[model samples]
Target: MTETDIPALLALRDNPPFEKMHTVAISGMGPVGMVAALRLAQLGHDVIVFEALGGLSAEARASTFHPSSLELLEQLGVVEELHAVGLKAPIYQYRERSGAVLSQMDMTLLEGETAYPYRLQSEQNNLTEIILGKLQDMPNVTLRFNSPVARVERGDRHVRIHLEGGHRDEPILAQWMIACDGAASPTRKSLGIAFEGTTYDDRFLVISTTHEFREDLGEDLAYVSYIYDPTEWGVLLRTPNHWRALFPVTDAETDEEVMSAENMEARMQRLNPKDTPYEIVHRNVYAVNMRSASTYASGQVLLAGDAAHCNNPLGGMGMNSGIHDAWAAVECINAVLTEGVDATHAATLYSELRRDAAINHVQARAQKNYDNMRQDDDAARAEQADQLSAMDRDLFEKREHQRNSAMFTSLRLTLGRLKRELHAVKAPAVSGGQKFSKLLGQGPVYAAGAYDAVSAKLVEQAGFKAVYVPGSAVSASVMGQPDLGYIGLAEMAEAVRRITAATDLPVIVDGDTGYGGVLQAAEAVRRLEQVGAAGIQFEDQLAPKRCGHLAGKALVETEEMVAKVKIAVAERTSAVIIARTDAKGVEGFEGALARAAAYAEAGADLVFAEGVYSLEELTALRDAVRTVVGGRPLMVNLSEAGDSSALPPLELAHEAGVGFLIHPVSAVLAAAEGIAATYQRLLTTGASGKGQEDWKQFTTLLRQDEQLERASRLAAGEA
Candidate 1:
């Protein structure tokens, strides 16, 4: 208000004082913001945390901490305090409105998979408060409450952070800044980043009461239960103090009308009637929106937690993903600050990892949960229930548990992808697509056929370069039919999924003639890539395509096949596209070679002329195709059923310039022979060869190794 103060402020704006410089200035002091602050302080970065609110927010939100969150909290040394006050909910249920338990999940099965196998049910504020306590004594940390960010300006070398509450004379200059502000981030808006997605028509209501559901719902009730009713689907969760229930309130009712005393009581009674008024602990109505920023980073400033993305909290992935984002942000920031990485490069890496986890995993799963919980179709509901209930088998249980616990999507897969992309650590384990992409230039890669997990594992154990999952073998094994396109996209994808999960080897899946057209072929490319196919081979044959070696196989027009190949290339996400032509059988050698060349021009990574006759012809075909494709690579499948069976030896084919050779039905044929012999001997002499594997070997292949190793350490007093 004074002339002297105006001049001082103008001077301050021009050049921030030395006292205002910090290593990092973070906006917001919520859970995500605090986690970043804690990590930065631990790493010796001078940190200043700004909170718009007076102190910690005590809103009744996000009480579930997943297994992966527990591990992360443990690393920060605050998990034990969380465990002390929180309830360990290891069992969650899915049920019908009539109280029929459709499915129940037991988290104890994850004992060996994670240290803390249960979800910790405590308010998120508890963890933030614990972190605050840890940060209070650190010399490098400053926690500023009620200090709203006035504006943020990104400069080339440093970011300027202006505080709103009585800090006009001071603007902090930070080496970098991270915005952990909540969903309605003005910072993101100021940077002109779009938060793009949909807002639901229904507003969700959360009513917490001391009224116990466990006492009324009987002994079979789980601490966490999702009750499905098309008209009034709801989620019931038992926190330490109260049973919290979430229900969707239609937009027909205004917020006040929906939250009226009469409406509230009636809703509670409708869910479970009580003779008296329910003891209400807390209630809130919030709009649910599934939205993510176009990009999480804007120049020198980065966004994390709810600032980067927010979604409907149906799957409890909201706060959990935010915390995961915090971890990721800190890691990326560490690279910039300590590892001498360029700031822009590190910021982009953070944006890709967190934004991907949000859009692909968190946002997608949450929307799916909302849809499934309120599913109206009777048959679809029944099928969903059956699928959930059917996750009782050990393999199914492990996979389901990992997915539900947020271990696979949020941590293992997403984080593994980040590590691989960074290539900063000794992290060899990466996404299969990356591994397969790296293997292309290396010559003479041979792939052995595998129809199942055991066969795929055996392929890896036998020192093969890759695993070849041919459609013919999958159709014969899974559907008991020849590869005449009887096996659909779903069936093939599932087989590919199982094989990819079973082995670390790059898998080349056979996509028989795209399954339909350019669009269907594009979908096939997406689905197969999703299930971890490193390379997908599509052949140039007409619908109901017979095996490539078969005589009755019809060839599609050369231009059409070329179009399909181009679509496959465009649709793929790092998967090698191999184009096969069965024209050698139908058309002559020159025709086949010409089609192959056309396909290569259409952007196929590998060219395959399916039925080449002799070694001399094959050699000439290889040289011609290689030259035409500019020496990318060529593929060949050596199966006894194929026309090339007469030209037997694999060594000679490699010498003929085959870059990738697949032993397409060899394992299936050998397995059939061995199994048939065992069955005959058992029928005749009453004894099966190797009557079941020794139980010990089976256990060793799975979860027993880590537990046994820990036990040995305990026994030896390794400390």
Candidate 2:
């Protein structure tokens, strides 16, 4: 049915009396706040929306609303109005730089899963206006433009909002307050909650034109397209009135150079090569950030939308997630007020659910979207294209992909968490240390090295017992540098956290020289344990230590190394501590055995005799350490190109009495080789050597279908 003829859908039902209802003060008049205010007013609560701006913005921002967001808008009674004005896009495409479509995603795969099976292309301002018009008719809704909140004071029963230049001279009071005040929220700052994450080095230039891109380029063009070009990756989206192109500008180019009339014209011409200069309607340059508030609630004040989390606009998830946050926050607030649930408890649950969604779903997805388009490596880009094409050809895979891209999975997960909370059902917790210990008890354990979460997932899929997070691998992959003690404890721990979060396998991290002396070692152990590390290996090397295989490495005194091991053992709760002695390369095998015995005496769970080159050397060292330390578990490094290059195979090492065998760089080396080959093929042939079937098999191994099943169960409230 046409949206203009859907009056029945837009009609509001009768609600409870508002005379005895409490008031809610919302600190922003953006789309999120407007939706929240309208929903609360519909539920018979008085709501006041305060906007710092004089009026709504005409600028283009966040133009795509996902299916999950459309469902919420439907609940708020504005979906019909939105449909009347906005454009519905059933497909989106990924294209090459020359405008050749490489892959296309059909949103129809989500037909049965969501009421609105396609994304809606509508400006943020359009939504705000429609919501405002409906709110003006409701007596319980009051919107005050140009009213900015200065500071908020939370009380026992209410919240006091001090205005900077509000409609009334006196402070405003409400039973609850919501801050939807954008990324740099004053309310969030006043509450002293940290907005933590990274900002992109490149700024995005959003240019809108009335010119018809589809007419010039082909009628087959989707409403939205991401063009992948190593030099100039950009995105194109069609609005009701205009088409917008988003281009990335690096710091190397000055703002004046990027925004100059000639440069802008040149960019448009390159996009389509039209004779006439593209008529510009609006243009804006803004920095994109991936940041989230540490907590979504502070006392009586709660944060929603951009105030709670902000991300790059690559995947069009920011606005949709914000709208979801609005509904969730209002629901939690309603539960507290009407259902007699404790306010603090409700707020805490809301914070946990929304914060996790923002971080894991919105931010992570947006970042990956940006990365996929902006990948500089030809081979990686081709591989990504192959994977997308594979998804396009497979029904189940496409449905799974649609679930994530359409934001249905995130909403389902959030609802599942809420359901579990309400039902008082707890999920089983998996302890990293316990898993590692279980594997250790089952005989010889071999761990594959991983530098990032993706690699860790590959290792887990390969059925590895554990993941070894080597310091050298982390330094090279994360920091793009050599592993000469350039990374600190915090950076390494964060990497460990990401890897551990991505896979269920136990992760053992490399703690280089424990980052410092005994105190630093203790703190490092504490931090690693907090991040769910299963084990940490500290080498007996001086500060600024080089890789064990590298030349010119120095060792710390045996007593000093023993002290650090003792401190690590004392500080960690359940994490296994492996003390690595590098004395074999410096002070010979006997000295290394002595240092190992000392570390064992200091309560080290495992002893690694680093730099053992040959089988004879390994066996002698292991026998001597066993004699000295009474059969303490020993770890052997079986590198393909490092100091242990001459070591025997895995079975041989196991037979030679090695409890743990780590191939620290084999995974990284294999990745480097595969990537180089793929890039070479793409550069030479302009096609990926890996076919669609190969990509389908690879993605299946990644368990994309299993993930979709879980999301489906959660959405059905079965999880």
List model 2 lDDT by residue over 253-366, tens digit each: 888898888888888887779878899988888888999999999887889999999999998998899888888888877766666666777788889889999999989998
Q: Where does model 2 exceed 4 Å of error?
A: 1-22, 166-169, 423-719
| Full-model lDDT for every candidate | 0.79, 0.81
Local lDDT at 181 for model 1: 83
CA lDDT of 113 in candidate 1?
75
Task: Flag clash pairs in model 1.
Answer: none
Instruction: Return the TM-score for each candidate structure.
Output: 0.57, 0.56
Q: For model 1, how does the per-residue alpha-carbon lDDT over 167-263 read when each residue is reduced to its tens digit?
A: 7334566767889889998778778889999899999999999998767789778888888889899999988889998989998999999888888
Residue 532, model 1, lDDT? 94
